[model samples]
Target: MIDRRRSRRSFLKLAAASAAGWWASLSPAGFAAEREPHRKPIPSSGERIPVIGMGTWITFNVPDAPGPMAVRREILGRFFARGGGMIDSSPMYGRAEAVVGDCLRALDRPEALFSATKIWTRSTSTGREQHADSLDLWGAGRLDLQQVHNLQNWQAHLETLRERREAGEVRYIGITTSHGRRHDEMERIMRSEDLDFVQLTYNILDREAEQRLLPLATERGIAVIANRPFRQKALIERFEDHPLPDWAAEIECENWPQFLLKFIVSHPDVTCAIPATSVVAHMGENMGALYGPMPDAAMRERMVAWVGDL
Candidate 1:
């Protein structure tokens, strides 16, 4: 569950004061945690990653330009500066891989990056080709987690992924689906595959996963990555009009972004939530979810009831 600050101006004030005691600023009433952000373990290898990761779908597909490229650099800067890990991207996202690589190269490649990408092609042979291309584009020798995007030709790609995993060319292998589509298939696959992670759409509004996929992942011991957490910011545009509930401070959410992200990442079964953005300030706003104590089961119940009513 997540809490909130009333407005964007107030949130900016918190960001402005981030040079010192920024963690304290994430939650009013000074509810910041210690220096480190929250992290959860990958169930398979017990490798821990930050609760708040990033996604590069539409946001990182930038034209090769000084102006656009510089903005991306600042975004990555804020991300790493805030202790972010697990950057998820797909070759299907046009130039996002290259732009991310360029920005990472400019920043000297953050060691904190948990590089995640997907093989999106339909043919297993072409999926292998895309895997190699993705490495070159992202300038990575091996992907930390490689998923079969949208489960396209998933069976064959999973085999290739397992092969790479065995060869130390990949650390984790998984599958992804979005927008609440194909859960039956996802469930079937999850039950069968020797997967390390699974990515899906799980948010306050998209709670259908709570009924099945999340619980199943927990039972199967598969790490989960939540995508489209804001429903592509449509949820924010809808809920920002309403005043944040009074209990928002209890969970340390200082803005709508934090509120939404915390709701997803705080789930016991969810390892991380990947929210994409191009704005540097928005990146900071998203990372704010990493601080302070997370909302407990009781508070999460309250959040659902309050937001559902609104």
Candidate 2:
């Protein structure tokens, strides 16, 4: 009979070796913890953007967090170093634009950025002026993309954005909707408007977009930017106790965060997923999703089951 202790030791060694080999196969970009890495191209424009980008909503809006904002400077530096670039913001996200501007100005690497912001307001003049203020705050001479926030007076704002695009003030213009509650409205805007990108919420838990918005975006040749990838921490709460699915190993997901992020970004129509993070380590793991094996449809279905209704 084989010695039980010896058998256990041998099994442990084999497991360690397997894990090492799996890590070796993963995209080294996120693992190195050195810089922002991983990029996906916009199908519509063929312009590649970092697969993982930052969102400056709650994190950059602290009333007295410029000191903390300085920490974000280091984070942005690391982002630029690792090949990350896209930074999405909106006037509604108060003070976020200013903080981002401060960071970018300090970094002085405007060329490395894929700057994006949204126009929010009913009046065309207010929207246009807000757009100009966003430009000033970001310190970017020409914005990369502009989206109408929630289609609020989108018609008027789209005209303003179009004029800006014509004047070389911005490169791309689009729209955004979240919570999956506005799918019908989002669809109408998507179908009627000439948009280059569409920002919306899509994840394993929130597949509403998959039924209509995602397919529509694909058919229309519009790029998709996935927001709320973690479902506002719902994913972590649901999966914290559950063991990582066995197949998750196939995608190099050693952690739940990586698993969720990869699942959202795996869709071919998804140009990028902007998962927000204030913690650097969390940012590192989120970027890891950008690298390594993305879930195939079958795997995604399994992933949905593994995290069902949770």
Candidate 3:
């Protein structure tokens, strides 16, 4: 087990000091942490994580109290029990890191967790500090993947990330943008930077990444993490009243969460798709996508055709 408190205190010192001169720190994985049915290897390390990872956008920004924290603990427990990995969060999400830390501690720190978070600060000098805060907040030993959230001050943060990666303080480095923002700039960075991963919005509705970013990730050997897989649950609410496609069961999609998530992760270039949910049942439905068959290129087109009509 990781001594998160000790790790946090140590990182606080490093994050606060002039040590490394904006060149340094935040950074965990355990057990096999990789579940069976389906897993994708990271392009840089070949580390396989489940395709249906959890996201903590609004779903995990709960108060640090027993009532809210207990529910979150169960929700996360359902995820790990379902063989999930690559739990993605950001400091920008209020109290999410702390909530997640409480949940992880509650769950006894599952061995299958692929902890991924971002450095969202625009100040390069405070970038390392933010990373440490995330580590401290999550009670995590280290971050498995540290991303430049929304590409804010991406260049400097990526430099610090590279240094941390070299020192084993960080594992993978990447940049992120969402809601179809800044594809042109993202493309430029993807081409120029030596990145291990790149996260952006890609879903049944958001196919823009397919035109450039998705293919570029494959070309550059950079893993891709798809966020807003459900368009922040708007897709689910929109389609819940509609019936699943008759062939939905062809891919073992039993609900909208499974249907929507399967469509995103089925894309060959997409490494994982994170759909946020606070409900235990919803989390179960999201994790179900990791099982059974996946949609193929033809089926994916059919998915777009169906959902795009609804």
Candidate 4:
């Protein structure tokens, strides 16, 4: 009745068209377009955090007076738009906590934040009260994560946090240290305490973390949050005149800051990295690193060698 050959040819044509469409949809750019951009998942918890987050240290601790608050709002807005929600602050950062609170109020984006702050005093009561005040300042009834700022009165605070974490007041508890000088102590604390995350300084220039702390954290299945990814601006100053190595292009790094950021974050143990920046453009550039290719072990070795030459 029907033309069998014609029907077969039509079916084959339709199948080829459908397959082409499917392949187009599965293409790399198509997949990237459909997916939200973020990298670095917690090994223990399976929580995927954007590899690049904002840090509120000196830059964020700007005067809580009228004019400064207005400017910070823009910075906060940019950070939010770029998928950067983890904001690290502390009592030591002076009025940063209050300023961030004002930003949150101005932005009305509380749920969009992965709020992180520290307990930086010396007594258990002081630490507990400080944390409570941080919660109040941020206007978040519960803290997403809190850390012992530089291990100051860490044991006392850790005890309180362990109880509170069980009671569900704090979702995660950890420790932090900024300088390479205290890394030994940081490692000791890591061994002694059960922590959810450990915040430390790690950048291209400061590979001290590679020696022991990072490896130990990975072994213990502890998450690592890198602070001072710019080395407090030291890396930029040191490597400014020198052009970025050609190999860096393979890892998607465009400049020294981004190169250093990628270097620290490329470590398999690093869960997330927070690079503080006040400028919106810089924030956008940092967020870009989260989307592109991350360095493999061989690439990481090459990266280290490249930096070593600098």
Task: Residues 173-193, candidate 4: write the lDDT tens digits.
Answer: 899999676898889888877
Q: What is the overall TM-score of model 3 with all chains considered together? A: 0.88
- lDDT, model 4, position 5: 87
* Per-prediction TM-score: 0.89, 0.85, 0.88, 0.85
Q: Which is the better candidate, 1 or 3, if ranked by TM-score?
A: 1
- lDDT per residue as tens, model 2, 97-144: 898888888888646689999998988899989999998998878899
lDDT of 3 at 145: 89
lDDT of each: 0.90, 0.82, 0.87, 0.81
**Weakest ten-residue segment in model 2 by summed lDDT:** 27-36
The reply for model 2, stretches above 4 Å from the true place, is 1-38, 64-66
Worst 10 residues of 1 by lDDT: 25-34
Per-candidate clashes, comma-separated: 1, 3, 2, 0
After best superposition, candidate 4 residue 257: deviation in angstroms? 1.9
Q: State, as a TM-score between 0 and 1, how close model 4 is to the true structure.
A: 0.85
List the pairs of residues colliding in candidate 3.
27-142, 27-143
Q: Return whichever of 2 and 3 wins on lDDT.
A: 3
What is candidate 3's CA lDDT for residue 71?
A: 89
